[model samples]
Target: MPPLSFSEGFAIAAGLVQLFVAVVFLRFRHGRPEWGLGWWAVTFAAAGVMNTGAPVLLAAMHSPFGTSLNVLTMVLGISTMGALVAGSRLYTGHPRPGPWWSFALTWLAYLSLMMTRQLWPGYESLIANGVTGLIFAYLGCLSLGAMRRESGAGHGIAAAMLCLYIPMVAGAYAMGLDQVELRYWSAVPFALAGLGVMSAMMGRMRAHLRDLNESLEQRVADRTHELRDIISSLESFNSMVSHDLRGPLGGMAGLSGVALSALDAGDTERARRLFQAVQAQSSNLSNLVADLMALARVSNVALLKQPVALSELVQESVQHLELSHGEGHAQPVQVAPLPVVACDKALLRQVLVNLLGNALKFSRKAARPQVRVWAEVREGGVQVAVQDNGVGFDATRQRDLFTPFKRLHEERDFEGTGLGLALVRRIVERHGGRVGAESQTGQGATFWFWLPATETPI
Candidate 1:
């Protein structure tokens, strides 16, 4: 045997590397049965075999089997091309390579023709070049189509694929013409294509990782918002419990001591009055604690929605007010013909009652004390309004209206724990609604809420 050329040694080294790559691809195929990775493994392994076997056949160039080995090399080249196309098609959902039977006929012709006469250096160069060119041209089109079908841009990849055709086929044809040496350069095309395939796969893996990262980031953002909301609620609860309960509790203690002093002086009337003051303070503390508990309950309870008649709810809320405050407490409440809406009835009832109660409470000293509850149909949803001829507030402070434990009026002026409107806001928001008030100082207020119209409960 002739001594190995530099080209042969390079080919052997390349073949070993390719075989190692094939085994790695095989492992990937075992891990993930998708993407036709097995075909890639086969193609790489086959290319390694062809590269390793080429030098032996080159040494026996004059022998008949040398020609046969050359033909087998062509078959291996075609197989690799087929595998490349198949894997790409699987990866990108692009079109498949042509049917097997069509290539079988061309391969048969090449094999049979070679047996009859040596065609490598003659007319066979043209035929082989034509076949190889056609294969590459087809693959180029598939790549171009895949690039178009893919959402992401791969202009460079498409350009590289389109550029592969002419040189690859024309260069092979030049080699067949005995114009190019078959030393180290014989396996260059395989190496180039192998590198290209590896690059494409790596790009695909990168895209997949990027998508996973984006999804994880979105989840983190959502969790962060929830965390912020929880912290805010906890702060509200703490401030409310400390501020609200402390004032009334201290008043009750001071009143108790005053009543004891009055009883020691034998002033029964003064002691009785002080005892009543203590009872009032106790009631205020009780109300504050109850409001706190209600706020906590609203946060935890998931709303169960149904179709509720707003007009009827308004009338019912008026009756509740009349029962609690006096028979004529709801006389000023003028409810409009409201539209039916999908919402939690009990929650919405609380909303109407709180708003209506506020209107009544604030308008109690007004000469007329006219209260109006109306509704209107809007583009995205329904709007409900509670207008009262009462002590209206500054519009600038409207932002604080929905905040827990936020009160615009002092407790001495308006008896409340500042949780009523906050609870109303929570109930509305839970039902996919938004609340806002429109008013100027002493012009009376129109507190309104917008509820999104849904065919069914979400």
Candidate 2:
């Protein structure tokens, strides 16, 4: 109730400021959550509470509450020191000896002082103050040591801690000699030091986060380059295979056809069998050439992006497949209305053609062979699907299904070059899309791909 002294007023103001700062730190600290930061938060809050309660304790100098508050202040100060040490250790990724010993020592020293308070209260206060001061000094030294080791966030925090301790040491020295007037204003330096330490800690944390992001970006770039190299190699290999094998296959087919034609004019039954064998071999050779060409095209073709109507592409592919299959009385391919997508029209047409052709080829022996093409809009892209009631492959072997020359069925049952889906996958990926299939053994398969939608003109 009485008029407060200058020291009491200053202490109260400083305590409130410390409390405000601590609260502000807590509010923003959630943005960067780490073990080191948690320790720092505990330290700041404890220190703030101690400082804020100091004035009331000083005002009621002779009361039991004042005595209890003073003890609590010392306890909190010791806890804060330990927290700073632990926090520094955590930030630097260093392991520390057990913290229980330090806690035990602090409490033991505090209790000893309390036991001797009746006989030498002033001496006990000085000893307790000195002990706390030493703890802070030790923490600061440790921080300085960390700073010298490297240029990092930890180093910056260490330097800040060291700076904060300078004034604290000065205040402690002044307080030990009963110079209450000089030590009374020590809260200013203490607050400044706390602010410096916190700022450094925040700066270091931000730097570390930036470094982590940079490292991740570098790893991603490296992986991208690796993938590009693999794709380039695959393209070159396919081109070589297609170019080298085509000449020999063509020669063999031509020679066989000539030989069969010559034998037909001389002998009847023998000529017929020879001619059939030549036809089968020629068909196989043609399939091999087609597959090799498909593989080469998928690997090496450069895509030219343009607006393409999905329905038109599907119809074109269906027509091409029909011509290749010899205009049979097959069930007609049905294509639904689809949206326009941004892609290389030629490559996309090829992709659809191969998918549809595959569907038709595999479904040829079915009682009701049907192939359907459709498109659907999705988030960030559009999906095109070609579904067929074909002799589907095993889902478990789907990975191998896309590899060149990997055939599930025997050559006699299903005639294919086995590069169709592989080519489809390459073309879709080249257009910045993904291709996938869903099927079970005996059930039909759905081959689908997603392409980025054309952006609307402003």
Q: Pick the candidate with the highest TM-score.
A: 1
lDDT of predicted model 2: 0.69
Clashing pairs in 1: 7-184
Tell me how far the alpha carbon of residue 25 in candidate 2 is from the true structure, in angstroms, after superposition.
5.5
Clashing pairs in 2: none
**In candidate 1, what are the lDDT values of residues 192-259, reduced to their tens digit?**
55555555655666777788899999999999999999899788778767876788888899999999
Candidate 2 TM-score, C-alpha based: 0.48
TM-score of each: 0.60, 0.48
TM-score attained by model 1: 0.60
Stretches of candidate 1 exceeding 4 Å from the true structure: 1-205, 218-222, 225-233, 454-458
Over 270-386, each residue of candidate 2 has an lDDT whose tens digit, in order, gives 666656776776777777777677666666767788888787777787777768776662355778778888899888888888888788888777788888888777768888898
Candidate 2 global Cα RMSD: 15.0
Question: Candidate 1: what lDDT?
Answer: 0.74
